[model samples]
Target chain A: DAGVTQSPTHLIKTRGQQVTLRCSPKSGHDTVSWYQQALGQGPQFIFQYYEEEERQRGNFPDRFSGHQFPNYSSELNVNALLLGDSALYLCASSLVAVSGNTIYFGEGSWLTVV
Target chain B: AQSVAQPEDQVNVAEGNPLTVKCTYSVSGNPYLFWYVQYPNRGLQFLLKYITGDNLVKGSYGFEAEFNKSQTSFHLKKPSALVSDSALYFCAVRESLEDFQKLVFGTGTRLLVSP
Candidate 1:
């Protein structure tokens, strides 16, 4: 009955460095998606993972990548981080058949790039 | 390109008063609309959605949304606003034809309920 869960509640990284944030989807969920919420802004879609492969992506560049495991957990990796990359990274889970219309989100990991 | 628009940057209302947050969207095909609320330092929580039912959709936390197909609008409403209802709200839209199933979100609206 646990909801979506994310790790490293807070992280700090510098320019050109890489960071990985983890998320465990809610029970009975099969798809995972990542989003970035900058200050004073709404959450922007990053990418989605289904069947252990990235099925959908947003306007993000190659610096952002993600992975979905057999257990339905997900990880979001950002490389060559820039100061603008500082934001709240959110992980949302849903069923593949659900059409990604309705999603459940985790508390999110706050990433700070300096 | 699908997109959502939340015209209000912030809204203020007294406790127990009715409140509304406006949203509009643009998409190619049948539009799947959603409303989500986000508290400080928390993830977005699903509030309500409009798929293909009555224009009026009710959801958790006493929230409801009315979808207007002709207007391409989905507005969230609450009969009696509570102080705890103060939060950031987002409207999203997804196109039925899109393969990625991505949701395009609006800029967000901040609601403040004062007692």
Candidate 2:
């Protein structure tokens, strides 16, 4: 089974621009989560989506938003991107029952905000 | 609040030698600890976890972590290090009281296994 798949392996955007990253969950998984990892830092939780609704969120600002389609695919959108937003955006998926416990991650999309 | 700490920035070891990556955690209620390894340009791969059971938990890639309650530590260990085992290691903790299931991760430790 294809684990988690992310699109646009790498992206470059200027400050104030917006970008959208995509993810496809692994087979038989229903929950999707996003994380941001800065250089030399561990991954930080951004938000989680289940049943097409956001179940939990981290300390991120409103500019960072996401949506999970019925097909279990997810999209992470960042509006008015800041240079500080440049980092590796990771997508993780797991069964809803596992919830906040066990999850698998994708390779991640590297976002470079200039 | 839950937090994890990987005190060492890097660890150097020769092949065939045993390796240990130290991890300490702080959490309120029962702690769910986890270890993940990340290779260059790759996502983090689950290594092992300590939920409830024996203090010695074995995980993927021949890795095992010992959970010590007194020390509040869960150190990752391998019997014999291999050159291919070099990568970035992360320790994470999840507090049972927290609803988000969010994991607070450590800064990460880089392991270098020289052949």
Q: For every model in order, what is the number of clashing pairs?
A: 0, 0
TM-score of every prediction relative to native = 0.96, 0.96
Report how far off residue B5 is in candidate 2 (Å): 0.6
- Per-residue error (Å), model 2, residue B72: 0.8
Instruction: Assess chain B of each prediction and give its TM-score.
Output: 0.95, 0.96
For model 1, the docking class works out as medium
Clashing pairs in 1: none
Estimate, for each residue in B30-106, the C-alpha lDDT of model 2 and write its tens digit: 88899999999999898988988899999998999999999999999999999999999999987872354467889
The ten-residue window of minimal lDDT in model 2 chain A covers A94-103
TM-score of chain A of each: 0.96, 0.96
- Calculate each model's fnat, 2 decimals: 0.64, 0.54
Per-residue C-alpha lDDT of model 1 across residues B1-115, encoded as one tens digit per residue? 8889999999999999999999999988888888999998888999988888799999999999999989989999999999999999999887773454478889999999999
Model 2, A13: alpha-carbon shift in Å? 0.8
Candidate 2's docking class is medium
Clashing pairs in 2: none
Task: List where candidate 2 sits over 4 angstroms from the true fold.
Answer: A99-101, B97-101
Name the top DockQ candidate.
Answer: 1
